[model samples]
Target: MAIWVCRAGKKAVYVEEFLKQEKIFCTWDGFDYDLNLYDDKEKLKEKIRKEKKDAEPTAINTWAAQLMCLKEKMQNGDIVLTPNENSKSYNIGIIIGVYEYKSEVPEHFRHGRQVRWLPDIIFRDKMPQYMIYSLGAYRTIFNLKYENEFVELLAKLGIPI
Candidate 1:
């Protein structure tokens, strides 16, 4: 299965919300439509441009790709790692459900996926340098480059991989 790095928010502002809600989410407030409806990134980019008129073309492209990745590319059973700045650790979890637009929730967290979080948290200091570097990616959502190493680490930690 694929492994993903899904940041809770800038500096992990929504980490607690994610833990409490038992899910991971993306925050593109004005784009309320379901991502599954868009078959291509270009179409999504067009919609993003209309919603975020102030955003640069590059930013629009990036958002479109990231949103698509979260919605379409990521599959159920894929492993997800979300940072918890307060604890200075990462929470490991399994993606357990399909994407959903929860309109009743806060605007920044409308797009979401169900997750079954593992009980253990991987501390930053204890992680290998390679894993640390991989998690340093700037994007909000991305595939973890060191997938095999990550699984081995989890095995060492006695957590089911």
Candidate 2:
């Protein structure tokens, strides 16, 4: 299964509440419509660019692609790492459902992907240097492909690799 890192918010502001409430992982692009209208990734990106008139090309591409992946590529059983602000640690989760739009939630978190968050925590200070570097990326969402790193994390959490 593919592994992914999902940020809680720009500065991890929602980490504690979301985790405590068992809320799903989500993002804000101010997109309130269906994302599946355009089958082509590029076309969808162009649409997003128009919707976000002031966004730079790089931001548009990154946000649109990752948002699209939340609906299209990310699947059930895929791993998710979400940082917790309160503990300064990462919470592991498994995607458990497809994309959803919840109007009841806050505007920035309406688009969501269900996740079965694990109870185990991986503290930031305890992570390996390379894994720390990988998590240091500024992107909102990204693949975490270093098997050895996950192995180490799982080991520390007492979950067999």
> In model 2, where is the ten-residue run with the lowest total lDDT?
20-29
Model 1 over residues 1-161: C-alpha lDDT tens digits? 89998888888988888888889999555788878778899999998999998999999998988898888988999999999885368999999988888778788789989999999988888778887888898898889997888888888888885
lDDT of 1 at 142: 89
Question: What are the TM-scores, per candidate, against the unseen true structure?
Answer: 0.93, 0.85
TM-score of 2: 0.85
Residue 11's lDDT within candidate 1 is 83
Q: Which stretches of candidate 2 lie over 4 Å from their true place?
A: 20-23
Which residue segments of model 1 deviate by more than 4 Å?
A: none
Scored by lDDT, model 2 comes in at 0.75
